[model samples]
Target chain A: MQIDHSENIVELKNISFAYGGKNVLEDITFNVHKGDYLGIVGPNGGGKTTLLKIIIGLLTPSHGTVHLFGQDICCFNKWSKIGYVPQKATNFDNSFPLTVEEVVTMGRYGKPKNDKIVLQSLKQVEMLEFRNKLIGDLSGGQQQRVFIAKALAGEPEIIFLDEPTVGVDLKTQEQFYRILKDLNKKLKLTLVLISHDIDVIASETTEIACVNKKLIYDNNPENFLRSEKLKKLYGSGVKFVFHTH
Target chain B: MEAVLSLFFIHTNMFDIFQYGFILRGLEAGLIIAVIAPLIGIFLVLRRYSLIADTLSHVSLAGIALGLLLKINPIITALIASISSSIFIEKLRINKKVYGESALSIFLSGSLAIAIVLIGIAKGFNINLFNYLFGSIVTVKQIDVYLIGILGMVVIGLIIFFYKELVYVTFDEESAKVSGINTNFINTLLIVLAALTVSLAIPIVGILLVSALIVLPVVTALQFKKSFKQTILIAEVISIVSVFLGIFVSYYLNLATGGTIVLIALGIFFLSLFF
Candidate 1:
């Protein structure tokens, strides 16, 4: 609950939450500054999703007040400044009959911006051609791209993506991250990504925070491996595999 | 002779229609039901809360039985009983104990049972019971028009203004809750709208027929559009077309109005399966 709130975009101070007599998150404290790319990783039943919910203002902490951009998270009226790409599983409904353009257009809700953000969002993810096709007919890669496009439609300052690469093949996963990196660099968009993949996240994210019911490790990825503290966080017999081409 | 006379019903000629006050009343009632039925139906289909609709309709049937037993305007009593049933269902169908459908089913079966008992309580079943049970196009009234129009506009207005929130919530309720949208109020608002539509349409398309009328249009459109906006647009179109065509066909062929419309809708739904 001792988050530094001086000039950060998101500051969580001593936040704790429990549901139905079971504690999911304990007195966790952290601040995400503007333009910071924070990646979250942890084992199952970890509070990674729970923490993301708190950031998105979905679940209020049992004991702490969240501050966003120098004000309370509850006070932030403008949602366009915070673009979100919920999990791929959450966005796609197989039985739904929707075209990619129609799904993408929903990104325009609640805020007014130029069509550039929409098209650019789609273009960045290489989904511009499939815009006319039904989302139900799309391949996994194209579907993922459409969701990312929709998320970026608002052109927010910070983008929150939860488990963006759950079931896709390794190549598409790599492609997705590469596209995200390009957008982050060219558009200068702050990214907050959550993934269960240890190796990929370790390489791609500028900052890493290992979470399991608490903010166990929050530091730069370069130092993440060397720290005995972080090594302990990942548990025993941890090994990283590297492929040489 | 019945076919020829029934086709005469479709003439709907204002002058000749009112010269025969029965036809005039029938037209008024049909139009009123047409407008309100779809107005209430959209949310029920969207929330996938069809059981409540089914339950309410059955409960409304019991109210109609009371009217038959006492020899009063069954429609008023039907509306009252349906609304009351909906209220009771809403109270117990909270986030605790069992699923929402279970609660709806309990009331649904109870109401249907009560209606059956009432039928037994009276003498030979009134012909009116069949009209309310299935469908009847010969019963529209002028007062029903004003009521349907006013309530229909209010419900549609609320939907349009809050369209985005509704879509967002329907897509993923948890996310909507996190975004600070009031899921509870919106849910109740949707149900209230559904109840109003049920009452409005029950007079023409009886409880069973109206249920199909409400859900069929929405379900059929879902086959063609995944986007909430487009689906709703398609649903309204299908509903209007089926109503108009069913009315015309039923009038000309001496058929049940509700059944004909639902058949037309089912035809469209089957056609979409091929598409």
Candidate 2:
């Protein structure tokens, strides 16, 4: 599962963002090396989602530069190489009429339609059996997996997921992380996952980047747990809940 | 045996109705709109922007007034007005300051006021305006049929061409944008197509009830909960049947054409609830 760290997949330099004249992210700098499983952990209103949006060109930074796959993001048009799974709460209308297979097929938009790719993507997440089922009929965890299959259908080299496990049950969350880890190791796909669950992210991700309107820490997850920065960032109220499994 | 014979004459009389040129043209236009309305409606309803159809239909009223004032074809003027106002409404919504509903409300009331003022200035066109407001399908001219056919094809063609993009954008705008789809352009294109639909439908469905034709069938189809393609097909069927029934019933009963069509659609919607 080892991947070369010689090349950076995403490079953010002095990224700063503001909303209504108030700063949300200030002078943030980081790099996501190739095939790296980067987890971004921050408290509510800490600009985690905004940071992700800037990297994916959903929101332009007030002042900074972003490079994706070595190309400046402003000129970057190869979006097929990047996949995004947004927060499930805001992803779709519950009343929308679309099958699981149809939702995944949207990933192949602008390209020739390929049923094999859609099926393969669904099988990757073990959701092939539900391809014909309505997307709205699925449970929260099942919906998340279908979204993952959607991202995979694009054959993306890197995928950014925002709060993907929110509202998912604990058992399903564990299974979801396992599936994500398997995707990273087996497929060598780069991942940038945002979560508030510190313990699970620290256990699962190869690298951890802490943000509190600043890049407080960006290094190995193990080192992050051992450092005093986690306590300083979240105050003394944060408690570590270890999971046996 | 007598009942069977009477039913045969009734069926023959129904076909014989088309021998009248105006009736034929009215049905022709209604059927075209029946296909076009739900094609645009499915996307609009999914995004909860169904009110935009209402807003644009009212805006077309102002366009019609201007057309009457200038002594030009109101459909052409209404098309210009609705399309331009659609762009304006979309721009206002995208600015993020004005809420989507607020933008629609502003256009709805603002356009209605303008239409009333123009109607007052254009005096002596009350009869024409009444026809436009309530829809006089029997008065649908040959030129209107030609215009509806050509422009209706354009709208349907564009919707089909961007079918995948439209579905993706309507389902999740953010993801579609991340995946390299130009969501803003697709959104504007959708409303403009809606404007085209609303304007073209004016001669048959009238201004006030145009949104019903666009919205009712889709809402009824949504009850089926089928896949996207199947749902659109169901909506089309509902729309076509409603239009056919409305025309036939109104022709015999001497009812308002627009009200008749919408009532039929509403009846179908209520009937779909039981299924």
lDDT (CA) for every model shown? 0.73, 0.90
Give the residue spans of candidate 1 off by over 4 A: A1-6, A74-76, A88-92, A242-245, B1-43, B63-94, B113-125, B175-180, B225-230
lDDT of 2 by residue, A79-119 (tens): 99998999754356676899999999998876778999999
What DockQ does each listed candidate score?
0.36, 0.79
TM-score for the A-chain in each candidate structure: 0.89, 0.95
Which candidate gets the maximum DockQ versus the true structure? 2
Lowest summed lDDT across 10 adjacent residues in model 2 chain B is found at B1-10
Docking class of 1: acceptable
**Per-prediction TM-score of chain B?**
0.84, 0.95
Write down the worst ten-residue block by lDDT for model 1 chain B: B13-22
* Distance from true location, Cα of A229 in model 2, Å: 1.5
- B13: Cα error in model 2, Å: 2.1
**Interface-residue RMSD per candidate?**
3.2, 1.2
